[model samples]
Target chain A: MFSQAKHSSGSGKTREIKEWVRKFASVPEDFAILVTELKCTEPGCPPLETIVALLGSENRKYQQKVHLSIEQIGEIDAKKISEQLQRQLENKEESVERHNEH
Target chain B: MSTSNNKVPVTVLTGFLGSGKTTLLNRILTENHGKRIAVIENEFGEIGIDNALVVSAEEEIFEMNNGCICCTVRGDLIRILGNLMKRRDKFDYILVETTGLADPAPVAQTFFVDDEIQDALELDGIVTLVDTKHVLMHLDSSSECKEQVAFADVILLNKTDLVSEAEIDQLEIRIRSMNAMAKIYRTKDAAIDMESILNIKGFDLEHALAVKPTFLQPDYPFEWAGVFEIDNSHLKITLSEGPDPSMSVSLLNIGEASAEDVTALLDQAVKTFSDKNISLSPGGSIDSTGKLYKLELAQTGSKTFYVKPKKAGKYVLFTQHKPEEFSMTIERNEIEIDAIFSTNYEASHTHDSEVSSVGITSPGDLDEKKFNEWLSKLLREQGTDIFRMKGVLSLAGKSERFVFQGVHMLFDGRPDKPWADEERSNQIVFIGRNLNRKMLVEGFQSCLKKNRQLSIR
Candidate 1:
């Protein structure tokens, strides 16, 4: 009975996506992974956004948002988000290296 | 930075509602002290009600009104103090009067924690006034009252005229149990000797130790403490569980000692751990059996350390610091090493669980390089959680006592008077949240002069 209910809710999908994104993005193991659904009422604001925030070392935060609800998030969305996070991290590392070079 | 002689003494005045704080402040301000005093008051209503001497502290208090005065108002106090220093000639002393419900830790912390403030101002003492008639009720109903009492250097038990002598005696005993160090004086309408409150170096290590011999002994329960005998020439120590991610592990070479000898050494180590006058001298050198193993991340999962005894005799490994997070176990090769000596208990009562104090006292001189490295890392990772820390240390190759104190990340220390007739000891106290006592105690132990006799070669 529990197995059938679990399969219907896609319970394990979020965990798999998170793990995949975390590995792809090369996020630190200690960083907190927060998947939050943000709602906004203002015009031009995304009515619903799913925010994947990586609370990293030194209080640094890296976030990627999808203009969709948490339930609507899927593997493709995770890949996009992870790519964005990887790009941001690469940029940050390059900037830090540039700072050190001087 | 101003010289110690030129630094003006600052006194923090605190009390509960109607505790005769104003009465005491008025006395200090209006008295013929032959020195000018700048008074900063954090009052709810009109500012200058006490007397013409009251300087408006509205800007300071309003800036900090986000709720907690100690943390939020600290910046404002620093600014005000810096401004006050510009007119240093106008006043020889500074007095800050906190609200009735204020926690004096942050205010007391200001003097010890700020570099700029530490330069121009020396925290004279914290004077807490208690209304004898209503203090018991306030203490029962309010945690602030208890904290004010706990951080007091001088507690003036005012309004003794309202309560009977027996009541005053009972109140004094109760207050003493909460804080055994503070000097409690019975007074009528907050009247006391001028000499008692002024020029009292309550924060000074020498004076603090003289007043309360056990001031460094905090009543915090050890999260984990154990003694393990290592007989293997090659061994690995793994921490599978503990309060925090880091733990302080001390490896003392007992040589081919008896069980009785081991017990004696453990007792001595525990005493050294508790005594503010002593620190554990670091252990003898150990040969590495494998690649160097780092002892970090032990709090979340497991951390390991590889040990190769230079000569197999008997090595005593123990963890005596309090765990800031969870309970932990030390394992050898995945096998749980039974603690030859251990303490497993829980705290029965706490005044403020969010903020606790841990005191570590050792009797030996420290390895300056190792001590600095360990402290820098500890403060870097855990400084925000560690609100205030102060210590008097005996450093290797130095006869003068090194007295160091810090607030979070800002730290300062200097050579105090040369070790006179008194024994040179390392006495340190840390007040913070989620502090790992075992880790701290062990880290400090690791910095001790590694068996000076062995190192001499």
Candidate 2:
């Protein structure tokens, strides 16, 4: 059965996840969050995983992936992924500053 | 290269108002295809789709926060499709039905910009439906309608019974002028083979570049051309109003009377159409040997205009409409004479004069670095105007073909399957606004290795 559980177009779980990413990551409204599950079918490829990426308004992207499906992903997973993505953004900015200093 | 073996094939249905997109959707859903098909409907926000797994969503367009103005997409599509992938086992095929008058570029860009969508779903094709009776009006004033036609891979000119056979022919000619590549299917009530529209694999470069020879062929302004042996004496051209009040035409002294000569002048004669029209009343004398002229036959029945050739040898007289439309005739003295060589040409009518298709197919290998530089610069300056472009290119010294496609600025390309036996060539078409054919062809020519055999339209 299709999950017709209290849906408002795209305002359902996808929005919830995006909001979660925004809240936990402490990112601005302009940052674009892309969430998808990439299922690996070939050898040496990453396994079935959930990817959450933050695309900045000024053309910056920081992404994080975990070995879990959407159904298995909880608040803790969202928090950890957001923290990792935030760290990546911070590291990129710090590196840019260091390059500018040089 | 991404594998399409497992990704769900998505077909986007775009159409004008009352083009029967919903009817076709209902029919597809009712058909027992032994496959699970997911329906994404925005049929006026929400449609009553039953049994089939349906998602009622609005068109949410999100501009990619990047600095590029043209980089926008249907945020609703990303969200809906992203959620659908979570339940990937529920459907085998996905159908996205967009409302009429919606800009299809953003919807198309959704698939292009999102990497995961590209991995999970194969953008099978964009299918556009057109109501034969009413499409002309929309095509005339609606930019969105023109974009739908320009971006379509499969165009269904549906509801043929409502319009006459001649009207349908006119519509087909008009649509063909806009898009030289889409497979057009005419049906009464959107009745078409599922195989024809679904799983068309239209985005596949190899299939996309196999453009027919008629693609780059120049569309002449005249609907009918007649080569007649004439002298310095004046010839009487007579016409009667049939449907339209007045008819516009152009005449050329075209030294030779052969069809090949006329064919060669097809590209040359197109410029005459752009000039201001000179109106002639009944029994008016005019010099039409090299210029475009109009016959003003309003309520005045059976008007006659005299054509005095600057010089007399062999001249080709081109008519705007088919000669039979008004029972037109050329008279030398008192007798109505026939043309020695005459043929009817298809009228290439563009609804939006600014937007057009430029098709270039040449037989040569391109300098890879030169081509990359030229294309990058071209897209950088004019990417906002470029709606969509697809091609299969031949790079010099490379055994495999360079297959590529683009939406606005974002492009994806790779060295595709090697050319084992087939002759390598370059075939590309850009559907966009204010595209300079000469500039595109010449730029593409600069990148060619041998610089031999370049043809464009």
Highest DockQ against the true fold, candidate:
2
Q: Report residue B128 deviation for candidate 1 (angstroms).
A: 2.2
Could you estimate the TM-score for every candidate? 0.49, 0.65
For candidate 2, the per-residue lDDT at A30 reads 49
How big is the positional error of residue A70 in model 2, measured in Å on the Cα after superposition? 21
Q: What is candidate 2's CA lDDT for residue B345?
A: 86
Provide the lDDT at B126 for model 1: 82
Expressed as tens digits, the lDDT of each residue in A1-102 for candidate 2 is 011011112224445666777888777554567764444333454434555666554345556767775556777777777777777777764121100010
Quality of candidate 2's docking, in CAPRI categories? incorrect
lDDT of 1 by residue, B185-230 (tens): 9999788887799887776645534464232223332334444566
Which lDDT value does model 2 have at A8? 16
User: Which segments of model 1 are wrong by more than 4 Å?
Assistant: A1-102, B1-4, B45-52, B59-79, B82-87, B105-119, B132-147, B161-181, B204-210, B215-358, B373-388, B420-423, B431-443, B450-457
- Residue pairs in candidate 2 whose N, alpha carbon or C atoms collide under 3 angstroms: none
Scored against the true structure, residue B118 in model 1 reaches a CA lDDT of: 52
Docking class of 1: incorrect
- lDDT by residue for model 2 (B10-87), tens: 899999879999999887887767668889888473444567899865786555322222356666677678778889
